[model samples]
Target chain A: MAGKDDDVKVLGVVVSPFAIRVRIALNIKGVSYEYVEEDIFNKSELLLTSNPVHKKVPVLIHGGKPISESLVIVQYVDEVWAAAPSVLPADPYDRAVARFWAAYVDNNVSTVLYTVLAMAMSPKLFDEQLLMFPGMAGVLFAATEEERAAKAEETLAALAQLEKAFAECAGGKAFFGGDSIGYVDLALGSNLHWFEALRRLFGVALLDAGKTPLLAAWAKRFVEAEAAKGVVPDAGVAVELGKKLQARAAAASTAA
Target chain B: MAGKDDDVKVLGVVVSPFAIRVRIALNIKGVSYEYVEEDIFNKSELLLTSNPVHKKVPVLIHGGKPISESLVIVQYVDEVWAAAPSVLPADPYDRAVARFWAAYVDNNVSTVLYTVLAMAMSPKLFDEQLLMFPGMAGVLFAATEEERAAKAEETLAALAQLEKAFAECAGGKAFFGGDSIGYVDLALGSNLHWFEALRRLFGVALLDAGKTPLLAAWAKRFVEAEAAKGVVPDAGVAVELGKKLQARAAAASTAA
Candidate 1:
């Protein structure tokens, strides 16, 4: 096993959800590492050099070799520090389920969040922004129109599944996985902020407290946890950013 | 490790890229199992009962628990028969990189292939199809237009990295990681058949012999190998299917 102080550094942007997922995972495991903030507008030399292929942030550099991709990085961190609180489930079936949902959240919810963010930031591209939803909706729901409408009728079905899984795993505990927060929580929690922000920005709610009470409560509980408390963006700030993004979207559309 | 059995059943459609990936992996490892062909048009009750969440094929039923998803099924197979040729590398870092690429291929390449398949199947929906290309191109190249163009100019640069990795690992051998094909090769090799079909379907090509000589050669070498020979689709059949898919795409677009 690599030593604790083997120059473990994370290159990331403060506002990035991808970066935050890694940060939360590392924090929960109590792994000590240096954090290097990268400016997306003007990426650092290290960021570019480290992740030459992707050249994106949230590159975890250990000893010299850099690992890119947020989900991949999380798995690497878990495997490298196996003795620490394991992020993945021990059983193969359970682990596969975890991965399936993680991939689902990444492909579906994350894409939706990006669409919402881009729309909020630049509403002038409303038609273009609307296209993003169909892909996401296709994944969340079934491919057919009836299936999509059914899924919309039960809007929070996917989120509800996560909440049930969380409750079962949490067992009345604070975190998603018993005592400490696990990988699933970390991935889902960051999206909670975006969901809240999107609701305010669009004035169309997706995950309501009534519809998905468990998930809504879990989101609140996750954010309020000690590990995540100060790290997350507040609802007010998120709303303000959401409004700014919407205004920008409108302006861009008008200009176009 | 679970005992090997002739009774081991795999429910999958031969044409499915995801199913074929697992099929190739199983054949590579010399794992014996019964293959149950699935009809995607009208899914069997067993598939629905087995994978209620996804309701997709490539479901490997061993003893009882059905494993869905090609990658997950690959891992499960590897775990069950510990003595069989290991698909994953033993070293943590190498394994991480291999896993990273496998996940990358699963997430990105698979999606691109779908879009490409869609485009080939229906030329009339070309405009709708083109919309999907930007995201795929962005990942393959760079984010911005200028950067993306530069990246395309250096397309072989990324392919070179893959080629070098394969060559070094294979050591002038047929398989990726030596005498027997390993996980990385299976993850990559599965795509070769589809690429071959696509080349014939569409006159324009991506993985040319001149541009990616090693990879192009590897594709031919892989299909001819004893392990991969049985599973690869015949050229005649693929062409017919491609034409049918293209016809379907045209009809759907016309209706739209």
Candidate 2:
């Protein structure tokens, strides 16, 4: 924790998609700032003071004022740097759709893909140490194979909604928010790397070419062009972390 | 369904708080618009086309483009009519907090208040007909009185978060957004009427002075000042509708 002499600074963790969202927006807007990495287990005083309520990552400190929540930070970046490629659309109606899809990404796409299966199948791990993420734990209590299978179907349904949204809203465009990778793109794109890693680890087939063609294609473009251009954290490192966690969950289950 | 000749038109149902949010924003911005009520039981073709993904109401049609989601519409109205008293704050950080609070109103205040507890406490009626509201039915299956009590306590906890938010963000202001009712006000204030009705019908003291004095005062101010001033649907009518539905839910529970 130090004085806010820096013009712009981001307080975040590496593995978090939410933090990555801020990083992507700041990069897209071409705003230069200092990046301070935080150990999520031991959150810094700066993060705590800046975001007392949430007490989480992706707090963008600009000219001494801190803005919390990833999407909010993205919108702040968009508004403050209005000249930079117009992250949100100029038209009011298009802006609404952009906002809607961005929210959809947050609520449906990212949350469901990352959190739901873990919460369903290996909830005990979450119950032990996931106090900060209250909602993510104890949702389904799917202990049995049949129960987990049913919960997996629900995750598919969630992804299916996103696929439908992509097809309907995008309407053959390069990005959901149109030609540029704007708000919706960044919101969902931050998690694409993790999702892909999960798909490889768990064989979930969330972005299965047969089921979600449009989304699969979008994911391909997002990873190859948008995310690989940098700012997104290493996918391999995250997946390794996830594997270790899954192994622990499995070990916990067997011991029980 | 008519063509896009109308300057502004809102496709919404009166009983919906989301619809009431758009109504309040448009009124605050001094924009005149035609209102079309949609039957929730049987949605119109226009509603389907306008909000294809959600198939929900409060879709604002300006010129030819239709903007879905109530908060999104409110933002659109705020952006387009930039001259009219900035619904969101002028400062970027303040704007982010406002946006975050507005979303909190949606995700926590409204959903946890009306749907989550009812769906958790009562199950049969939702099983019969609440297909569109997938999340509202059969969650937790808290059929026992003790379970219901626990869930109710959780609801109060959620409300307490909002109370904390109000106190921290408002900082002695009448509304969360500022002196006048703005984005956060409309977002949370739209449901104040419904909460009041629930308090009366169910005898639950949600806005008790002892626990949530700021929110209690805020609710009173919102109802008497912002909501009762013509744009919001009559609270009495909404309460009556809610009563009838509650009666049905009671009946369904007994039958089950």
Candidate 3:
């Protein structure tokens, strides 16, 4: 049997915001674990077996038992490492609010932003297989520049809503969890690099300082947190990765 | 300020599986609350204010504070009413597994199943405004019988995966929570009536006795539970509602 320390393993890709979420939570909880980088294009057998349903990365294998999904993994980490600082709020209502926003981040904000990023980077990636989320394609992806611009507008609207949520949740605090980073913080914060990458490379401003001042300020503070040190990737690195992936996708399309 | 019992109120529509999930949880916890059935077509001011983000059904209001989303509400109910028979598994690993399955139910099984039902009943609902889920249109909805059959096949495949999960989670127990209804049970169980309605009216067998025996059997046991008595609406009534909505949709389309 593996020891307590060695038993914890995270199967993830460094570039993925979902994978980074698990790392951030583990870092905050002060839990050390082995990180196995998966080739997302050609997934590892371990990852495939670990998450047969989704076959996605960021599977936290604890005591030989695999737990998939970033949010679920974060909560699992918080629960198992009970001694560490809590990821979710101690209060039930507050926890629910956190859960709600985290879900909003996933369903409304992150998916739209990421889909738009994918569209911007590699239009070829919009093919059937790459668009894993079926229903969101219409609302998210665009064929023409006009439609893409409209989608970007929708992204801004979502960010504006998140800005409001942050105001309510933060209640005049540094982080969404007040002094320290909490569930909602990690949920949106994990994608900070992607937001930066979008703005720098594509001129797509998701977290605008002028529009969503609180969230914009929150993003700056979030990246500087001790737990965020190595977990959150550089915006430059993200842009490079996006370019590499887009080239590969383009090549694949040409070959086909 | 409202008293303990009176403070709790649910803003929901009767036919929505999502709303039914909240009622089931509250019922299981033995918490008393006033149920406000919202007209989904013309959402009330309270419903709009309560759930401005989603503007959907199943908002749990406790002491003037509102929490939206069915799964989030179930967890909130479990946390706040900690003394009551736990809705989620006591073990964190078990809890994570349950959460994963519940998410799968929402993403994979329920959405596909429900969307197909909507397509079958009201084809006109496929219009831009009603097709709220844009990308999913390609994979989920079908204008032709052949395409719809393929989508149904996909739903069945998803169910097969859930069947495997049930075997792992149940481990010869009656419920997903092991001898009692837990989070996953409620998550999937809320759609029992709809599943039945689909099967009876459209011959869309989602939870077939032959294919997924365990889940089919589990559905029976789920509806029989005391918590499911009033919460799980009648399959016949669901069929009637589907017919009424279909007629209305057809009329609107013709009029347009």
TM-score of the A chain in model 3: 0.85
lDDT string for model 2 (A100-153, tens) is 888766655565223432343445534432212211111122345464454456
Name the lDDT value of residue A109 in candidate 1: 61
Best prediction by TM-score? 3
In the range B1-256, model 2's lDDT, one tens digit per residue, is: 1332248999987767888888878777777789999876577999989887777778998986789878888888898888877789898778888988887667555652244223344465343333222111111223454644554565567678878888877889988877888788888777766666656655555567888888888877877774337655565766676656555555665676
Error of 1 at A64 (Å): 2.0
Could you tell me which residue pairs clash in candidate 2? none
lDDT of 1 by residue, A15-114 (tens): 5667778877777667777889876546789987987656776888887878888888888888887787888877766676676667656654654335
Worst 10 residues of 1 chain A by lDDT: A134-143
Q: What TM value does model 2 have?
A: 0.80
Candidate 1 wrongly placed segments (more than 4 Å): A112-130, A133-155, A164-179, A236-256, B2-7, B112-130, B133-161, B164-179
Where does model 1 sit among the CAPRI classes?
Answer: acceptable
Please give, for residues B118-167, the per-residue lDDT of candidate 3 as tens digits: 44434544333232322222223344567557667767887888889899
Alpha carbon lDDT at B226, candidate 3: 93
Question: What would the per-residue lDDT of candidate 3 be over residues A1-256, giving only the tens digit for each residue?
Answer: 1245467899987878888989989888877889999876677899989998777878999989999998999998889887789989899899999999999888756652344334433454444334243222222234355755666676778778889989999999999898999999998998787777666756777788899999989998999999989889888877776566555544544644
lDDT of 1 at A160: 66
Model 1, TM vs. native? 0.80
Find the candidate with the highest lDDT and give its number.
3
Clashing pairs in 3: A134-B135, A134-B136, A135-B135, A135-B136, A137-B135, A138-B135
Q: How close is each model in CA RMSD to the real structure?
A: 5.9, 5.8, 4.5
lDDT tens digits, residue span B1-256, model 1: 3466555788976656677777777775677788888766567999989887667778888777777778878876676665767877766677667776676555434443354334443454443443334322323213245744543344335555567667756678766656667777777776665555655654334467787677788777777877777776765555665566545554555655
